[model samples]
Target chain A: MKRMSMTMVIVLLLIPMALFARGVSEDVTTLTIAGRDGAYGDAMELAIQSYTAKNPNVRFELLKLSGSELMEQSVIELRGGTGAFDVILIDDPFLTQLQEAGWLADLDALYRKKGVAIDPDLVENMVNIGRYPYPNGPLYALPHVGNVALFAYRQDVSRKYGIEKFDTWSQVLDVAKKIKANEPGMAPILFRGVQGNPIVTGFLPIYWAFGADILKDGKPAFDTPEALNALEYFLELAKYAPQGVTAYQATQVSDALLSGVGAIAIEVWPGWIGNLENPELSNVVGKVKIAAHPGEVKRSSSMIGAWMVAIPKDSKNIDAAFDFLLHLTSAETQAMISEKNGVPPTRHSVHKISSLVAMYPWYPAQLDGQISGSIRPRTNYWAEIESVFGDYLQRALVGNLTAKAALEQIQRRVTEIIER
Target chain B: MRNRERAVYSSFFYIVFAPALLIILLLTTYPMVTILYDSFFRYSFVVNTRTFVGLGNYIHIVGEELFQRSLINTLVFTLVASFSEVVLGVALAFLLKRQFLGKRVASLIVIFPMIISTMVICAVWQIFYHYEIGLFNHVLTTLGMQRVGWLTDQRVALASIILVDLWQWTPFAFLIIQAGMGSIPSEIFEAAQIDGARSGQIAVKVTLPILRNQILLVLMLRTLDTFRLFDKVYALTGGGPANATQTLSFFIYREGFKFFNFGRASAASVITLVGVAFLALFYVRRLLGEEE
Candidate 1:
């Protein structure tokens, strides 16, 4: 009796395994994608629904994760050669690391196999970010989100102060000072001042505009005079920022802008300020102007923070994933996603659509930033460099370290990271 | 016949316990050994490089100023938070020892924070800590005082987090101590009363002496838990305002997951583990001495 029962259990387990094998051999194809959450996830869901409707035989398993979670999971799966994820989203900064590791599929070969030329509708600068050895290399991913950091200010406030336009960092500082002295109830300036990524990203445009490169000829340039000037200027401007700004994030900055409590924001992202035109959500609707950051020693230098989609080299459904990738980035799909979800589109035609441009009044400025913005230095150690630089920068902002001392410390740490 | 039965029992014991013992070894011992081994190398996930550099990772991590700050912050948090929680827990336990009207409902209310999720608690507190619109600042404004930077001020951020921890975990210590108090014989208190002992004297001389083991256990658990502080700092401050709240676990997380520098992260983790073990040993020794 015992032997018979054991045999029964064995057969029951094997039966499911046999059925699963048969199911895999059948015609149905399931493509697994590791993507982002929030509005990006909603956009991916819309695309998936549209594609599966057109191709009835294809199915999808979408894993919506946060940015850091997506990177960690994708890296682990790719490194293990699990063939678990067919498609994955890579944050622009992490693209260099993944591409350099040779974990991503070669999109150039896939394009050749499909006998289709890369579409020019896609913005050239956005597409260039997906290539390793950067500006020119084998294509391994396609731009999905055309995110760029821009400056925002209350147009009415600026007009009241008799400032027509802010063309220089000095002008911005002057306006901030005036707003602080005049408007006692409103915050003069706003930006994410939290340590790590928030503070680093907010500071980059000013740093670049002041002519300080994080890496010059593959070495740390933070100890230079330009860096010192930028940090000093930032410290001066920070005095006008909201109290407890060191804990501020995107939500806080956007809240301050939308509520008409902030007169100017030194840093704003396309995703964060998408509702600025809606009066229901924003009290400052049509009252705020978004533009490229003001220049100091150079022209306005915006920072590109795009998100890209790629296929893993060990994917089981690479062919189907490539087809979905193309469909996902096509002008029509981009337009649909952008109109419905307010996700920044990567295609020029989509950005030029009259309906989208009407909804997002800053489309022209966004597209301009995308075309002429600066990408962070392409280095595998960008994450470490950003963290170290942010720590010291926040220290200076909070009066814990002098600006020159902060720059010196950042220079020393970044040099150590690169050497390691 | 007895010998044969003994042999059979021993065989059955091995058969029943082998799988569990093996699983424990795999889950605990395996990773610990692996971490120890990895600490001696320079492992970069991006470059896919693993270079053996004995003692180099430990030396480098120990020499880092941030690591030193994180260690000191962790120690301060553990000592202050854990000590406060245990003392408050014992006080509450004594207060509730005698039954009164609404005692059951009061106990439930006191333990509410412990039952709720930490993330949810953090979200609620984040709003309460907001500079301009928080409840505390509103009260302060109404009272004609200045608003405080709860999470942004370096000097006060760690204390704010400790308040949150004490609010959430004191009930856990209370529950354990209360149970221990219940298990003690009531006759001892009556006997002390017959000898003219006051309530305060009885609590100090009789009750506390009897609850030594329980209090020590609570201290040990709370200390070990608080020593590895991560979630509160991650959600509240991100170790900001000049790294005032940066703890060892946050440092290890940044090094290991954010940067994927396994060797340095492993070394940091081993050091933290040793520190926690030492703390646990101190409490355990106290408990054992009380028993003796």
Candidate 2:
């Protein structure tokens, strides 16, 4: 009787194993993507739907998350070598740290294995952002989102102040003063003043324009004269900003610009002003002009904030993820996503699409910025550096510290961080 | 025979207690030991590297200005918010101790804030505290007063967060205290009344002493919860307006996750654990001494 019972248990287990083996032999592959939320999530869903329609044997699982949540989850999962995610989207500034840890699979190797070449239609500068050691190293990812920081102003407001163009930071300040004096209840200058990433991103273009750099030959440069000048200039211009501007974030700045209450925003993202031309959603349709940031001691340059997509080293479906990446970045897909979801495209061909250009009049300027924009200091310690820089910069903004004092304090803290 | 009976009892006790003991060790003791070990090294989670630093991390963080500021803010937030909530909770419990009209509805209304999600509460309060168009600012403007930066000004930001926390958590304290008040035998109050005691005397002499254990328990829970304040500050301030609302938990989060400096984060965690353990011991000792 005991022998019969053991045989029954074995038969039951064998039945399921045989069934599982049969299931595994089927021609279906499910690729998991750790993507971003909001418009990016919508765009991913559209691409998944299109891909599934063409290739019925493949399916997808998309984990749509916020930027921070995505970073935290991907780090934890990738660190464990779980093979839970096939594809992951990374912020450009953070890609280096992940690459340094060898978390991402090599796209160059995958391309060579498949006997194919990289698509040249994607903006070369954006594509270079995914390369470790920056611009001359092996490619590990592809650009998924083309984000460039741009300057925006109310053309009518500037013309009313008798200024045709902002050629420098000083010119911006003069225009801001005139707007504040003449236009009651209108904020003349706006930027994200909340501390950390928002404040640092908003301040970098100005910092760079003043011939100051975060790192000069791999050391802190905040103690330089140019950094102090840029900070003092920033504080003076901030006088014409809205009350409670220290609390302003992307939402507040974008709201002020869209409602016509802001005359000039020192920094704006393409994603934030996608609906600026829509009459129903925007109060200043056809009245706003977005362009490259103005210069100071040096020439103007925009900041590149592209999101990169890569396959994790532990992903079980690297080939599938790589194929999907190609589909996701193709010019046709980029144009479709731009029209339907308002995600800026990373391809030259997509930028020249007449329909897209008409909808987004800043496409030419965005392309120019993409070609010549500056990437944030690429380092494994970028997060720590940005955090320290932001904290002291806001201390100056709120009058807790003078510009020179803030720069000196930043120099001390950042030098310690790098040394540690 | 007595020895045999004791052995049987021991066997049953072991059988019943083993699973819970194993679970407790796995869940609590293991992580505590890991954090303690990691605190002694300069650890990087990303690079998977660790260098022995002895007490360097602890000394460095203790001397850091940001850590000092975060500690002060956390202590101020805890003392003010928890005491205010407990006081308000006791007051509301006494005022409603007697039978009143619409008692069920009143109790429900009093507990509404605690029942709602914290993120939802934060969203509502964020709108109410907006600088330009918020309800509070609009009312102030209507009364011919200048608009206040409720969240933008460093002086007012921490106070505003404390107010929100008190609003959301006072009901929790009220529920526990009211339950304690309910469990007291009515004859004690009657005896006090027959002894010529007034309402105030009875409340102080009879009711409060009887409810001491419950109050201490609630206070301990609130202290521990408020000490680990993270979500509200994260959703509302992001520790901003120049680090006005940075708490120890926020500091540790930024160090561990944002900067990936596990050694400093683990050190901060160990320090927080010791502080919380000390507070728990004080409350537990008081409760035990009262019981004896």
Best model per TM-score = 2
Question: Ten consecutive residues with minimal summed lDDT in candidate 2 chain B?
Answer: B148-157
Report, for all candidates in order, the number of backbone clashes: 0, 0
lDDT of 1: 0.92
User: Given the true complex, what DockQ would model 1 score?
Assistant: 0.72
**Deviation in angstroms for A77 in model 1?**
1.3
By summed lDDT, the worst window of 10 consecutive residues in model 2 chain A runs over: A21-30
DockQ of 2: 0.74
TM-score for candidate 2, please give it: 0.96
* Residue A304 in candidate 2, Cα distance off native in Å: 0.5
The residue ranges of model 2 lying beyond 4 angstroms of the native Cα positions read A1-25, B1-11
* Model 1 chain B: ten consecutive residues of lowest lDDT: B40-49
Per-candidate DockQ vs. reference: 0.72, 0.74
- Give per-residue CA lDDT, model 1, range A58-77, as digits (tens): 99999999878888888888
Put down candidate 2 lDDT per residue, A288-360, tens digits, no spaces: 9999999988999999999999999999999998999999998878888999998999999999999999999
Per-model TM-score (chain A alone): 0.94, 0.94
- Measured by DockQ, the strongest candidate is 2
